[model samples]
Target: MYRWEQRGNLWCLNPSRPLGIVEMIGGGYLAARPQISYRFLLEELAAAGLVIRAWSYVPSLDHQGQAIAAWHSFQHEAKRSGPLNYQISRRPIRLGHSLGCKLHLLAPDYGRDCSALLAVSFNNFSINRSIPMWNILTARLGLRTEFNPSPLETLRLIKEKYVNPHNLVVRFNNDKFDQSYRLLETLQNRPNDRSQILVQQGSHLTPTSLGINDYGHNSWASDYLQRQQIGNFTKKLINWWEQNAC
Candidate 1:
């Protein structure tokens, strides 16, 4: 059974285990879709012996409120679970994907007490503006749009306040190679050189697609897990986090 609850404007998923970290899901419209995505990611993490608490928020409204909710969940879990015996001490890490990364980056004031941040597929200002013309046209027609907040403002805030000496931002480069490269360039210009950048083979959307369980098919989870690229990427991400965030 899932330990689900609505905390203020955020939907919280607290797995029935001592929380080791908190992951905030990025929803483009409503909480349900991202919650489903996060559930898959959490299952993968749980298989690797990491307990995750997740938050899903409504996209159009409650941006600030959702950020605060994520912060509170981390704080509450840290207080409850105490320190970890892992590499980077027992502090809880904040993991964000896509637009979720932007939200976390912009809300530095909220998660000031978090141990570190894992930003998956983060894009910088110019790179965000440089989205594919096709994508822009589709979005204009309300066809293909992801749940991204004010990406430029978010990056500016992160550069100004969040990316600093103590906390680290590890950006995973997947499909959006251009955005990832631009993000690295922007980080290089920042004062904090402690941030890390990694370019992986997959794209920004691949991770979510890889983790999906097609219930309509028989034994879908097992079949999905058997794919070569999925298995390799999953293992690599898990190992990388264990080595770095632990």
Candidate 2:
């Protein structure tokens, strides 16, 4: 059994016995209701002895600002919640999916907040790719909403600001939207970096269970094979988090 609570933008979960804390951020809009879509993944982590604090947000034009806000929420909530023993021994491991990965990388104090980062299906798409064609056209014709740190700017900022040593980036085979390789390369730019990328046998949405409109709702996502694949990924993540927490 587990307990769930909401304190502003975070969803806090406490299991019967927790091994560590996971500060989780889901991709873009998915972050708004991560509990509903990531039910299986959240449960699996809890079962493996993780107390989770899932941050929820809808991205605005202010990329850096959003990242900073999320980071602050993690710190304040971790200090306020969690068992005293767990708090003293371990910093929450940062877990992110897709755009959430980008946010974590851009977080102002990312290096100091968590022990390591576990990025699943990391993505940073161009404005044209992320928004509808109509919106793109509108933006060009005067209706302007800046994508603050554009994809290129995001990479540049991460290269300059993020300096965490331990990082595990996961990429799904069929995730066309994923740019984990680019992220891994950026992380490797620093000397003696211990970042590693793991390729799994699933799509971009494999880490996500909500199942989007049509492409994500296919039998492939719900089949036994896919379930086993995701389960394996979750197990590996839990093992890595436990083994690496100092």
Candidate 3:
């Protein structure tokens, strides 16, 4: 039986025998929906004895501040929900995809919140790349505003504020929008940083299911390969969490 509950504004899924906890934040607009790729990932994790708490957020100019507030809120609610709701005796793992990765990394106390963070397809695109060409042009012309803590600003903040060293950054083979390498470099700049990157097979959207479009190639073999790739990635993540997030 699936046990669903609401803790604060986030939704929780309890497995029959949860071994640990995962707090998920999805990328881009998909973050607004509960049915993103993490939904599938969470299902697999549940079968392996894990519970999940997931939520969505609307990105704003003050994304950094918003990220901090959201992280704190998630923690506060998780604690209030009591230990049984999540296996709180064991620290929860942080999982984020695309823009969600940035939000988690930008939190001022990022290192202290979770046991470890798994960031997939970490994206920090410039304003122009994030929006339509016309919108970019308009923003460039001062006719429209752009997201604050821009890509550069976000990187700078990560260098200055983020202290956590245990991070797993994944980038798909053909994900044109991925900026994981950049984030990895910034993280490795810290003398004690243990951040690492994994290159997986598939595209930028391979790790996520946006629910609006088909992912991978339009072939049976392609679909099979993609599924296999995601399965492998999840296995690695679970193993890492068990070894490190605990």
Candidate 4:
């Protein structure tokens, strides 16, 4: 009864009668195949009566450019005359995981692209921190390797240019790579800010596990736990938005 429809690099889950739409972006590497990497979480949201629009891409060094590209993709689709065109009256909620969180924040919309944003395991790290021995290897190879804005620049940009205040930052207890606290501080310092954080039991990779079936050869205690956490996270997400009704 549930199937993911793909068009180019964008994948969608159109419920029979969608109550709202979720525009999601997954973390690096895994984002290249979001339909499969994020199958479990996306399916849960879809089954809960929400349409899903997940963009697929491999993270590139140019974070800002990628962000712009993603926004345009969604915007262009919405302007088209079809089911993909969300109603003008209701805005969709944007979701991002890890590096995808940075991409969403860097989007050139001033945060007006969605009703609100849900960032899970927000990760903003320098090229050296993100990729082990990156600087050393680059220096030795005489190569120029770095994130376009760099980590510090990213934070500065968010503090100065990001305008939308409605945000929910979720940091799994075990996600050491998450920089939610830092992001929260920046958002809170902004005018008319309304940002919140939720800590739960999970990991950085927890948001990407397929959990395709109860047990499908990849089954293990950790896998089961991941599934449970996925379910838990989904419930919290639905509950939070419904109570706030954004």
Task: Candidate 4: list runs displaced more than 4 Å.
Answer: 81-89, 210-217, 220-225
Ten residues in sequence with the least summed lDDT for candidate 3: 208-217
**Higher-scoring candidate on lDDT, 3 or 4:** 4
- lDDT of every model, 2 decimals: 0.52, 0.79, 0.75, 0.83
What ranges in model 2 sit over 4 Å off? 82-88, 143-145, 211-227
- Per lDDT, what order, best first? 4, 2, 3, 1
RMSD of each: 6.3, 2.8, 3.0, 2.8
Write candidate 4's Cα lDDT for 1-246 as tens digits: 688888666898888877778888999899988888998788889988888889999888999999999988777666652654444345788899998899899999868767788899999988888998888999999998779888889999999999888898999887779999999998899998888898987677777876533233365775776667688789898887766534
How many clashes in candidate 1? Answer: 10
The local lDDT score (0 to 100) that residue 242 gets in candidate 2 is 65
> lDDT of candidate 3?
0.75
**TM-score pick, better of 1 and 3:** 3
How do these models rank on TM-score, best leading? 4, 2, 3, 1
Candidate 1 yields a Cα-based lDDT of 0.52
User: What TM-scores do the predictions have?
Assistant: 0.64, 0.88, 0.85, 0.90
Clashing pairs in 3: 19-49
Pairs in clash, predicted candidate 2: 19-49
Cα lDDT tens digits, model 2, 1-246, are 566788889887777766678888898787898776676688678777787888999977677888889999987886676454454467778899998898888888857668899999998987667876847687678875547788888888777778787899998887889999999998899766888888877776777665442244446545555456557778999777667644
Candidate 1 lDDT trough over 10 residues, lowest sum = 209-218
User: lDDT by residue for model 3 over 128-178, one digit each (tens)?
Assistant: 678768575786787855567888888888887887778999988888899
